[model samples]
Target: MIAIDSSAQPIQALRFEDDGATPNSRFPVLLYQLKLAPAHDNASAFESLFAAHQWTPLWRAGIFDYHHFHPNAHEVLGVARGQARIMLGGAAGQALTVKAGDVLVLPAGTGHRCISSSDEFLVVGAYPQGQEDYDTQRPETGAHQQALARIARVPHPEQDPVTGAHGALMRLWQ
Candidate 1:
C-alpha cells in the first residue's frame, strides 16, 4: 500500500501493480488516490500514472473534447477540490456537475465528457483497465460535432471512429 501524507510533503504519487497477469484480461481491482497539497504547489500526484496513457487534466480555458471509453473498462472519478461538469452522451446531452468530495462512476460503455472549471483547480482519480472497442451503433450528434470543431486544436490519441471519443486499451506485461 502507498500512503500520501498531504499534511507534510503535500503532493505524492504512487502506482500499485496487479499481482495476476494476462495480456487482455481485466484485473479484479484497480486503485488510485489524490491528495491536495497546501497552497504552495499545483503539482499533481498522479501525473506519472496518467502520463503513461497520455491522459492529463484539461487546464485550458475553453470547451474541451467529449471522450468515451470502451465497453470493457470501468472508470471512477473522485473530485478532491473545485467543481467540474460531467456531460453524458454527446456534447449537448445531459450534464451532471460534481464538486469536492464527490465520486462519479462510469460503468463500461458509458459515454462521458467534462466541462466547466473553477479557480481552486481540481484533483481527480481515474482507473481504467481491460480491452474493448467503441460502440458503433450510437453516433455523434450535431451539437457534439460543433463542439469538436472548436477544440480540434488538441489531438486525440485513441479516438473512436464514429463519435471520436478518446480512450486507451490495457496492456499486460509478462
Candidate 2:
C-alpha cells in the first residue's frame, strides 16, 4: 500500500510538457485523504473545511478513458475501494496509481482522467464546491469512442448499449 500525504510534506507544483519547447505550468496541487465511517457524512466534512455549493460523484468501470475538467471549484476525491490509475494531462507526466484509503486534491483548472482499474469495485467520494470555473471536457477516444460508433451493431450489455465503448468493466464476471 502506497500512501501520499501532502499535509506532512509541502505541496509542490507539477508541470506538464507543452507543445512548445517550454513546459506548461499551473498552480500547485496538494493531495491528501481522511478516513470516515460509513455513517460519517463526507459532505459535512467538506463544509467544515471549505464553502461549497455543488457536489457530485463521477463513476466509471472497465478500461481507462480520456476526460478533462477545467475546474471552477476545488475537488476532493476520496478513494473508497479498489485501485485506479489517474492521469493528469494532455501531455506527459507521472500518472498516479491510487488505492483505497487514498485522498487526492484537485485544484481549479487541472485536467485529469482515469487510465485503469483493478478487479475489485472502484468507488470514489467526490466533493465539488466553492469557486468559479470548474468545467469538465471529455474527448471521445479508445473504447469510449468505439462504443459510440458501433452502438447499433453490437447487441450486448458488454458493448455499451448507449455508446458501445469497450473496457475492463464490461468483462467483469457477475
Candidate 3:
C-alpha cells in the first residue's frame, strides 16, 4: 500500500516571483516527504499513488539540468531512487536535496533544474489528467509576458498528486 506518513508534513509553501525572464508562480511549491510501503518496483509505487489521485504519471527519468518551467500545467515529481540536488524557482531559487520517497508539487510557471544527482537517481513525473498537455518554457528575452498569461490561465489541479481531493494543495492553492 502507498501511504504517506502523517508526521512527514510538507516542508513549506515556496512562492517565487516573476524575475523578468522567468515568470515564476503565484502559488507556492509544496514538498512532501512520503513514507511508502516497501516495494520492489519503486517507480510503480509512485505511478500508482499519483494515478489514484487523478494525476497521470507520464514519464520516468531524471530531471533535466537546464532550467525550465511549465506554463500550461502543474507538475508532480516523485523521487523513486537515489538522491538529487535540485534548484527550484529559477536562477535565483534555492537548491534542495531530494531522496527516495520525496514528492514535490510545483505550480504552473515554477522554475526548476537538476543541479546534481546520484547514479541511480530516478523520478516519476506526473500531471493532472486533463492538464497533461504541458509546455516547457525556458527563460527568454521576450517570452515572460506570454508565459505569465498562460500561467494565469492554467487551472489549479483538482487533486494533489500525493494526497487526493482533500489534500494540502486544495487548501494552499486557494
Candidate 4:
C-alpha cells in the first residue's frame, strides 16, 4: 500500500508564458499534492477546508475535455472520486493523474484539461470569495492581453483552500 503522511507531496510549479496559441502566464500553475491514495478519504474535506478559506463552493463539475483556464479567479479542485490524467499549463503541458484524496490549487490563468478519466471521476471545484463569476477561456482563442491583465489582478485567496494558511499552497503559490 502507498504510505500516507503529512510530508509535502510532490509539488509542481509550471510557468506558462504567452505561447501565441494560449495566453497563460504571470502566476505559475501550482499543483499541490495531498496524498493521492489514502486509507480513508473524506469526500467533504474539500468543501470544509474551502469554506474555512472563504473560497465559496462554486460547482461540482466533472473535468471537461479540452484545455481551459479561468481568467477572473483562482480555483481549487478536490478530487472526490475516481482518477484521471490531467493536462496542466495548456495543451502542451504535462499530463498527471490524480485520484481520490488529491487536491489541486490552480491560480488564475492556469490552464487544465481532463485528457482521460474513469467513468466515476468526480471533482468539486471552488473559487475565491467574491469572484464566483469565473470565465472559462481556452488557448485556442488568442488575444488575452486583457484577460492576462484581469488574471494578474486576481488576488490569492487569503488562505489555502485545502490547508488553510501556511499550508503547501501559501508556501508554493506565494
Candidate 4 achieves a global lDDT of 0.74
Those runs of model 2 whose alpha carbons end farther than 4 Å from true positions after fitting are: 1-25, 33-64, 131-134, 139-174
Per-residue lDDT tens digits for candidate 2, residues 100-164, read 54555554334567778777635443444323333454433343333223322322222211111
Per-model lDDT: 0.36, 0.42, 0.87, 0.74
- Candidate 3 has what TM-score? 0.94
Instruction: State the displacement of the C-alpha of residue 51, model 2, in Å, after optimal TM-score superposition.
Output: 8.7
User: Which candidate model has the greater lDDT, 1 or 4?
Assistant: 4
Per-candidate clashes come to 0, 13, 0, 0
Order the candidates by TM-score, highest first: 3, 4, 2, 1
lDDT of 1 by residue, 1-174 (tens): 212232222111212221111111122111122344545233243333343444433332222345543333444454556777766544334566655534333333345556666766465544332222222123234344432332232222342111123321222111
Q: After superposition, how far is residue 134 of candidate 1 from its true place, in Å?
A: 11
Best of the candidates, TM-score: 3
Q: Tell how far residue 108 is off in model 1, in angstroms.
A: 1.4
RMSD of 4: 3.5
Q: Supply the global lDDT for candidate 3.
A: 0.87
lDDT measured at residue 8 in model 4 versus the true structure, 0 to 100:
57
Relative to the true structure, candidate 1 reaches a TM of 0.38
TM-score of each: 0.38, 0.48, 0.94, 0.83
RMSD (Cα, Å) of model 1: 13.1
Question: How many Å off is the CA of 127 in candidate 3?
Answer: 0.4
